[model samples]
Target: MHSVVKLADAKRSPKWTDSQTESGSDRRFSQHASDLVLRQVAKAYRIDGKRLPVLEDINLTVEPGQFVTIVGASGCGKSTLLRLISGLERDFDGEILVSGRNVTGPSLNRGLIFQDHRLFPWLNVEDNVALAFESRRIDPADKRRIIQEHLKLVGLTGFEKAFPYQLSGGMAQRAAIARALVNEPEILLLDEPLGAVDALTRLYLQNELQRIWTQKGVTMIMVTHDIDEALFLGDRVVVLQSRPGRVRRIIDVDLPHPRDREDRQIARLKKEILADLAGEH
Candidate 1:
């Protein structure tokens, strides 16, 4: 089981010595300090003047460069969990630590990709990616290079000038991925990023995402509904129970990367996972 840190003691948490860096007048933590820890995480919402709990006693830890996938039924607070981790939702009870530092709000260190591409309709591929660097003081030439490199990273080398309307669904999503990665965030949060694509495209993108994760070695926590996709890409699959979403079980995929879809172990795990989701344990 992963260790859980108490929220009250978050202020006394030890700082990661090697993860600190001086950037201008501010102290910035390196993207390399990507490990995430959640302790006693819980959330609820007010519905018709009554409180409805969504996630309860959620505790999880994701090591740096680890690919962890979350699978659960709809309305299981899967997306809400991602929102909390990404620092988009702060009104919750928990301590979310990234490299020992508490996550108070959205930071450039964490990147979020949604189910839709969410790219600007007017911006071309390269420009859409360049939007990520707009707030920084990077040189124009360096920024352009970074954009082009990320585009190439997602197999959009020749489509730099193409607009979102001109690209296929898969291509647009690839551009979104490129945009999310341009900053080289330590953790990439994906919420059903491939759910909007066709089956063949989704399969192809799964392999591509795995390749990207292997190449970048960035920590990834993806919320997916497809058990096969989750098993195929994740180092560990986190199965969550519905209603008040909670960790039901965490299964380790000991197989090496570039895993075979027809592997006997994978088949067995899939069967086991399906049974678990069906409450058949």
Candidate 2:
């Protein structure tokens, strides 16, 4: 995570707040649920025996089943922030609570998807997804059923026997998503999971992800560099400035589901975001 985020520069909240933010129109449900809170969280990377700050103090609240996107220039620590929330980094300074419990380490409750599919080349699609449930003590039949259902959930219903190499980039990533979700995580963390795919495939997966998230009711926080992607998929898009990345602005995408990227409103925000990123702020 040698990203551009420098922890020393992240602004922190003076006091940790416990009150949940009111359910915005973006939240699907009437009541609050699936909240992922980060309070003054900071992270630093160790490279060459030296400490480099990646993310400074960060505070955020993500409502249940909400699709939140974080966008920044490369190295602005967007991915590092996700890692901290995912408990991939223990050396950071901060408090992260998911649904009211402190996150000590990785849990089956938090599903993480990275840029690389990270599938086992030796395993088939069904087996790769089933691996997520390995530590659990569920029955074999139950596991198989879960795997089958999730494959369908990710639109990979008929590709059970396909291996990672056998599938296209988009399909493999979808399988990877099935694996992350097979465990039924409460929160989904996506770190540019579609970054490596071709443009057409990336666009297709983006829409598929929105449908999946909406149908499943799992909280989603995606980190990406594509401003259009962010505006297209996020309920609220958070913009970060580079060099010790900090939350510059949070925009509410009030449009309804199945958004059209070509919509005039989205196009307007896209230009504004691009302008802000270009130092026209």
Candidate 3:
């Protein structure tokens, strides 16, 4: 049997420290300081010569190295909002800023993860991860070292030769995550990244994600439907209301890392969020 990569044992205390920051990379999250600001942001789509707004007046801030989760009903434009922050949806209105600079387009400082793994089938794991650095002008040796470090960070070091088909759902997602982080982005934007995995694997990968977030201290803004997952992982949870999506509320988790699933405070907050959502209907 091929050696399966175990997600639980995959993460170690990250050895890639602040001193190793790539040249010209701002390394904004090193001291826990990647302030993300969104001001009066609005997005719309046109159909049949009519404008249909998807998001409206979205204003929020994510502190550096903070884990911020967004939860809302379908059509609330959660994913669309993330797209704006990623600079993929340039058609939107208003301002998006990271570390006080306007986000005109995507840069190496921002990494994005979609729900699907989206790895190239023909590319082996290492090559797939390597794709993130195609435009970088670094030494080949440095690139190889960065890739290896990220693979270990995500727990796929030994499976570098494996193809996407050979990896399980969780492992494929891990590879995708590695690809995103290899650039050492100051912020990672996640769009329901764990939604496709099985229940058990989802739980395991959530732990792995927490470890990676802690070790790398990268600013993260993730969209998830699971209230429990949001509260567990997020320092703050932003809820949006649909029909021209808008910020309904922002709830603070106020819990420490590696939180217990059964904590009473989490349960209470969950009820509050559920009630808040139910009221929107």
**Highest-TM-score candidate:** 3
Better of 2 and 3 by TM-score: 3
- Mark the regions of model 2 whose C-alpha exceeds 4 Å error after superposition: 1-33, 47-50
Candidate 1 at 218: error in angstroms? 0.4
1 or 3, greater by lDDT: 3
> What TM-score would each prediction reach against the true structure?
0.88, 0.86, 0.89
Once model 3 is optimally superposed onto the true structure by TM-score, how far is the C-alpha of residue 200 displaced, in angstroms? Answer: 0.5
Candidate 2, run of 10 with poorest lDDT:
7-16
Against the true structure, what is every candidate's RMSD?
7.8, 8.8, 6.4
Q: After superposition, how far is residue 33 of candidate 2 from its true place, in Å?
A: 5.6
Candidate 2, residue 240: Cα displacement in angstroms equals: 1.3
Clashing pairs in 2: 3-75, 4-75, 5-54, 5-75, 5-77, 6-54, 7-55, 7-56, 10-56
Global CA lDDT computed for model 2: 0.81
Better of 1 and 2 by TM-score: 1
Rank order (by TM-score, best first) = 3, 1, 2
lDDT of each: 0.85, 0.81, 0.86
Better of 2 and 3 by lDDT: 3
Query: What does candidate 2's lDDT look like per residue over 102-218, in tens digits?
Result: 998888888899999999999999989988988889999999998888899888999999889999999999999999887778789999998999999999999889777766667
Lowest summed-lDDT stretch of 10 residues in model 3?
A: 1-10
Please provide the root mean square deviation of candidate 2 (C-alpha atoms, Å).
8.8
> For candidate 3, lDDT tens digit of each residue in 52-88?
9999999998866778999998889999999999999
